[model samples]
Target: MEATHRVLVVDDDADIRDLLVFVLEQAGLEVSWAETGEDALAKVREHQPDLVTLDLTLPDMDGTEVCRRLREFSDAYVVMITGRASETDRLVGLEVGADDYMNKPFSPREVLARVSALLRRPRLGAPSEPASSVEEPAPVAGPADAELDVGGGLVLDSARHVATLDGERVMLTPAEFDLLRALATRPGEAWEREELVREVWQGEFIESDFLVDVHIANLRRKLRRAGSRTTWIRTVGGASYLYDPS
Candidate 1:
């Protein structure tokens, strides 16, 4: 449970830091703090927390950059906390790999709830090797557990947590893979964003429609970058998305 989890709270405001630390600690979780992005990176490297509460306006660097850097070495659940409550700010934060985010003036209980919900899910794995590094495609093995080789140059193995496109490994974030798998498992089915949130997050978090959209955008981009011959996913009249390997 989250009570046994480790969390790093990164914010320049000492009062906010103290408040978050107190709330998290009261819930029986080990907590730490950092005032700068550099310190946050150092702390993450040293301690490897299960979750991080990052302030978007860090004195040393932008929270998006911190999250981008953190994604390289760790997949800790990042909750970008910001004083700005604009859609553009949320988009930027989500673009950099924040699993979730919230605006300022939030209740500590909500943070704890979000944290508990996030920690309940599997950690998004560390980022894969740079696209330039792979010299050759690894040969695909026999049919895998819960395999979904639906043609169209994409293969998803749910049990093994792998996705291959055109016999080459498709670099995918864990969220992207989960979303792809959910859609691929039931191809041709229109999945509303809310339904995807439930499928991917297992109904642990709500009000995550944009999170689904952002990750879906990322997934489609990666699929194209990986050389899919055609669209493996498509949107349903701007309302939802579905897997369409044709």
Candidate 2:
């Protein structure tokens, strides 16, 4: 028998909390709610949920900060649901470790849909225990073709949910790891943004082109920070991204 999937809903508004809880519970998920950032963090630490729905505005702290702090200890997928709809806001949200972003006045059905998409696709490379979060920075290299064992000593261990650079662990989000695996598996293959969306995200959630760009950019930043000496992943055109081992 499979274990029940758990979700935490964090919003300052009681109505929104109730709505999300009701919707998720109706969908056969075990749901929890928190009304403040600190409480949300506490609940996450305690529950070790599979996902979190977070509002950008919290009474105790900004939602982005909450996410950044959460990333320190938990890799639970986060969806930033807020009234802020600016490009800057969305980018910042994603940059801080949010897996997805949604504007306010959203349909409950759409919220359910995105949540369902995320829940359906747990970390493909998660470990036996939990892919809860990335370990301390051991950044190394990217993957290569065929078994992701190429790219100048970059190796990916899918069964273990780890990618190593010169044998150093390169911490990656589940999506980031999947993206690297896709590129590394087919070195020199230029994938259009739309195609990538389908490839990585399984084409289940409705998303704009920027979603791919943001994730790719995040992947790049992490690799660079991990002391990568080469730009392994590159853009071929306005709409295509590829991994080039050479």
lDDT of 2 by residue, 68-164 (tens): 9998988788989989868898889888888887888878677766776565553534422211122211222233222457577788876555678
lDDT of candidate 1 at residue 166, scale 0 to 100 = 72
TM-scores of the candidates in the order shown: 0.81, 0.85
Q: How many backbone clashes does candidate 1 have?
A: 0
lDDT of 2 at 130: 18
Question: Model 1, range 1-246, lDDT digits (tens) per residue?
Answer: 235678899999999999999888877788999999999999999999988999999998999999999989876778889999688888888777787777788886677666665555444333222111112222122333566787786888755567898788886655676778778878899999877776665434346777888888888887888876688888998979988989
- Looking at model 2, residue 139 earns an lDDT score of 20
Q: In model 1, which regions exceed 4 Å deviation?
A: 1-3, 124-151, 157-162, 202-206
- lDDT per prediction? 0.76, 0.76
Q: For all candidates, what are the clash counts?
A: 0, 3
Q: Candidate 2 — which residues are off by over 4 angstroms?
A: 1-3, 124-147, 203-205
**Candidate number with greatest TM-score:** 2
- Steric clash pairs (candidate 2): 140-165, 141-165, 144-150
Candidate 1 at residue 49, lDDT? 93
